[model samples]
Target: MQPLPRHWATVRETVAFPNTQEYALTIHGASDLSLEDAQRDAQERMALLIASGGPGQLHDSGLEYYPLRRLPEELLEELRSPGGELIAAISRNRYGSAVLNTDALLISDVDLVEPSPQDRAKPAGGLLSRLFGGGRQAELTPEQQDPDAFGLPGLHRRGEHHERTLHLIEDFRARHPELGVRSYRTRNGFRLLVTGTGAGPSSKRARELMGQLRSDELYMILCRVHDSYRARLTPKPWRIEVDRFEDLGTRTSADETHHAWVARYRAASEDVAVCRLLDVSGPAPSAVEQQIIDLHDRAVRPESGLRLA
Candidate 1:
């Protein structure tokens, strides 16, 4: 039988000056570029804006950048009236980015594979497949290696690898009966409903049990998050902050232990906004049945959060 087709997942966010006007450039580079490199990219972009606009002055805070502005009349007149045309001639002969930037593409991506049922279960194709592919596959081209080689990450969203993650999670749930998970469909991607069961003398223990379950679930998910993006040459996604949360549990005023968890986890993942509960008996629930319920009185969104440690 022919082997399954390879799957790649790519996501790119247009980098901006945040509070300033947008520029003609974005920052994309090596998968492992460091702090100094990022700042250099910013400086290079500032220079580019000058070229596009011509003879300007610009500045930035260590944290943010300002769009280039034309130098004042006195300075502009001095440079132009005397040697400007000579410099312009030299610049015309130059043959690269009008800007000083070497990193023309600011996008980053994680290479992925679409594994079949057989592949998903194979120890080689499981989590490790996220990193190395089905052990000794054909080498990827240089374009396939560095997303920059292609100029852009992709024209549209690539979510088949996402389906693969869902499959991995299902396999995780099957192998580990101690935990429970459900997928929450969001506008762009999936959030997870995570819960687990454990017995304890006090609600404290129950909360701990729930925490452990969330931790384990996140470990598996994030393992994929980091490991799945296997390309070593191109940049990986800039930020990995929490996108959303599936209602994991709800809490009454009296459910202090659970409520405390809600506050702590929610604060930790302030980006998310939703909550739910699994009868306070999750992962390893005791006698209570695992009937999922809203943590609030009205039909509220699941603001509860996950700790992807």
Candidate 2:
């Protein structure tokens, strides 16, 4: 996924949280922005996004904006611990940079690496700042308690939470076109980082809903994502569905129908080479069965027999 481009500081340093109970969001632009500015900006936007129904009460947003392939395995291991939320992906300034816990994580300079990970441990609820009193969340040491948390930038680890991560990324792009949009699923739930500005609801209405967002309402905004892109991507009736699939079997006419070779980049969890039909129809009775047989034969792997291609 093309990450939300960093503009905060030209240079960023990602510290391995090292089993810390909490973590920082991102440091992509940290060099340009002061720790205070980064800290304040991330916190305030996160609060608004939460009020608008973004992920609420997260400790750190994790390394939300940068690309992750650049990081190491040990650092990736740490992100597996539940600690951050999608708030880290939100761009606070036109710079398209964000770091929710700059206070907690970026208090001083440290090492850096690529952002992104694949572990999900469910972010705990409530504001660390609120608990610590007046945004002093950074003062709390890792030894305090809580699971040592870590996370992937931009990428969702898995589960319904992925919906939140993707939604935030889309939200930032939709909210601020100047930042440019990143890859994301379509409005109908299909994974497609559609082009153009988002769809429906003036920015005002969209902002209103976002302000009132809560865990329950997270889906509400995510749903809007599809609407935002539905028009931009290729138009198709089926794409509206998130993971819909059909058995691509049964007899059908060859007319109007089309055939094409297909393969899934996904793992073999699904029947590898299974003939999943896209659509079916026939002009005449004989055509239906022949069309199905031909497609089915081509789709499924052939038995131990060879024939002319």
Error of 1 at 254 (Å): 24
Scored by lDDT, model 2 comes in at: 0.25
Which lDDT tens digits does candidate 1 get at residues 216-255? 4333332232221010110111212322212223212246
Over 109-173, each residue of candidate 2 has an lDDT whose tens digit, in order, gives 11111223432332323222233444333353332221111222321122223334444544544
Model 1 clash number: 23
- Each prediction's whole-model lDDT (CA): 0.29, 0.25
**TM-score per candidate, chains pooled:** 0.22, 0.17
Cα deviation at 71, candidate 1, in Å, is 43
Q: Name the TM-score of candidate 1.
A: 0.22
TM-score (C-alpha) between model 2 and the true structure = 0.17
lDDT of 1 at 116: 64
